[model samples]
Target: MNQLNVCLSPALIPLYNVEDHIVVIIDIFRATSSICYGIENGAEAIIPVSLVEECAAYREKGLDYLLAAERDGKVVEGFDFGNSPFSYTKEKVAGKTVVLTTTNGTHALHLSRAAKKIVIGSFLNLTSMCDWLKLQNDNILLVCAGWKNNFNLEDTLFAGAVVEQLKTGDFKPDDAAIAANDLYQLGKHDLNEYLKKTSHSERLKKLGIEKDIEFCLQVDLITAIPVLDGEMLVKLQ
Candidate 1:
């Protein structure tokens, strides 16, 4: 692995000296997409909470919040909204604040407590995330929200997308991204088919969110970069 810092999960990422690497968090299924929508449509800020209770707590702190959460591909109880970009329509969320929680994405944000700087990544902002990474100092870590603390292809594939773009940078792409880039290059001709092979696709199909999968798999439709400053993910200026 060399001096290239890499961690699959925040829970597993050892606490060490990593004040330099760019930490890109990927939740390709939906959370990042929703983040894209919120930032693109002029939402004030999106605070990502690891738990529903956390979101509620933030709302109670006089934030004037819209609570959004999702679990197992469905909305959670006692929340203002769910994890869908469609729900973040400009008409509904523009000029407002949001507290977001998700089964995977927000949890991933919470886990990276030791990251130097955390940025949300998805197909939509693939280029922006990488371009930002290119401008940072040496070393980079791609934290993937593996399904239930296990290896997940979709997250890694998104990481690979970043690696592909940083080919000539002073970055140390993890081996996971190496393999992921291989898969991405091989199936790039029919990305949908490749995405269907991921565990997320199976779960989405079972949850009847095949359409969501389609929406998430749409690449490069947006350039909005959602950056995590503490628990809140806001538009990257």
Candidate 2:
């Protein structure tokens, strides 16, 4: 049986042997959820860059990349859009390559480069993500992109949701995975209400982007699974 572990924050990734595991990068407040929705809506690919400058550099590559940059819960100045899933409509992203950098999600992707395989995870594609994961032979590592390297609730709750799904399979859960599953069970009934007091939720509320929170919490709206292929995320074929 493959073992399943959850790393609650990107800062703790170094403690895990990622090279031998399939890493699921979770940033449910926005990034991964947006990736899933964009790909499902016909995005050609998404290029996750660690820095805003790196995302900008893709513009000069002549690929007509759509640049999406986010910082501190808002769209960066001079970018096409931020990390909101609503911004990734079919009319906008269809057959286009998006170069994206977010405050936490892209940073977590960079930190997880050594993993055997890296896939984006979010509530948007929860069932499909777990279905694909169960078919893989590699051990699984759920890496949460917490708020600025500090643990956050939304990502951890999503990780816990994944753990709940995978635990019924031929996978053994680590302590973190166990904790996440428990947390998910506690919050699954009413996610929006359950997260009302979380720091990230409060932060987004103050930014007046509460709708993004409601959207990200929707389960299995997308069937696409975005997997990292070299430097880009493409829908799993």
Candidate 3:
């Protein structure tokens, strides 16, 4: 049987060996969602770095890449853009490479380098992500890029959404996975409404980006699966 599990936070990442499993990294607030949007909008690739300086270094090298850096729910100073799904439009990001860094998502991506394959997951591409996972034979680990290494609701809910879809497959989910699935079941009906009171949601709302929140919660908006190929993320066609 195929084993499925959820790592609630990156702090628990050391507990698993991503080398042999198919790892799906979830950061629903924006990072992963923005990545999915960017790829689907025709961005060449996204290079995820864990630090703002690293993302800036790409500009120092005179690279033709858009620098997107966010920390504590806001855009980093000097960054060309923030981690907002709406920022990555076809007209702006098409044929451009994006170098991104975020508080939780990019850190999780750096930590998940050992995975056999790393997939970016968010509600925007929920269906496509699950579709890709169903075809893989390896064990599946949903690694939630929880806020600052602490548990967050949005990413956990996304893990559950994926688990709910994989129930018919040969998946044997662990306790954490089961918990996430239950959460998803509860919020799947009205994700935007259910997550409105979440810490991350409230934080983003304070910044007046609720539209991005609504957009990120919409399912199946895109069919692209952003898979990490070495240092950059590319759409898996």
Candidate 4:
């Protein structure tokens, strides 16, 4: 039987035995959600860079890719897009490659390199990600790319959602998983409304991107599971 665990932030990743677990990176406020949208919309692949310069260098080398870098909840200057689901429409990202860097999400992905497999998780592709997890039969570790190594509500809720879905499986959840499940139980009724008061929600709302928040909370908007293949994330078809 597999077990389910949760790490509220990447800072706590080292506390767990991640090398043998399937790490599902959750950044529901935007990053992972945007990645889900991009892949479902037919983006060729998403290369997650940890630094703005690294993302820009992909373009400097004349590689035909969209440069998406965000810091402090705003799009980094000179990038093609920010970490917003709306920017990844089928018409825009189809057949295109994206080099992505964000404040937390990409960092979490990089830190989780020791995992047996890295799967991107967001509410946008909730069910599909769960399906993939069921097939793996590996211990699950939901890694939340919280706000700069601090805990955040949205990611934990997403983690809780995953745990809630896997409740029937042969799994033993850790304390973090139990906490996340409690959070999910509290917010599962109306995710958008439940998360309205969260810091990240307020941060994006201040920027007038509430639409992205709503879209990010949507369940099963797509059926793609973004998995890290080498250095890039490609849809697990």
- Best candidate according to lDDT: 2
lDDT (Cα, tens digit) per residue for candidate 4, span 90-155: 998999999988768877887889999998999989998898898888899999999889999999
Number of clashes in every candidate structure?
A: 0, 0, 0, 0
How do the candidates rank by lDDT, highest first?
2, 4, 3, 1
Each model's C-alpha lDDT? 0.72, 0.90, 0.89, 0.89
**Candidate 1 residue-wise lDDT, 84-152, digit = tens:** 778888898888888878667666666665667777788877777777777766577777777666777
lDDT string for model 3 (1-237, tens) is 978989999999889887878899899878899999999999999988878888889988887989998766578888888888888999889999999887688788878889989999988898888988998877999999998899999899999999999988998999999999999899989998888778666568678888888888889999999999988999987
Q: Which window of 10 residues has the lowest lDDT sum in candidate 4?
A: 199-208
Q: Give the backbone clash total of model 3.
A: 0
Write down the TM-score of every candidate: 0.88, 0.96, 0.95, 0.95
- Estimate the TM-score for candidate 1: 0.88
Which stretches of model 3 miss by more than 4 angstroms? Answer: 71-77
Off by over 4 Å in 4: 71-74
What local lDDT score does residue 222 receive in model 4, on the 0 to 100 scale?
92
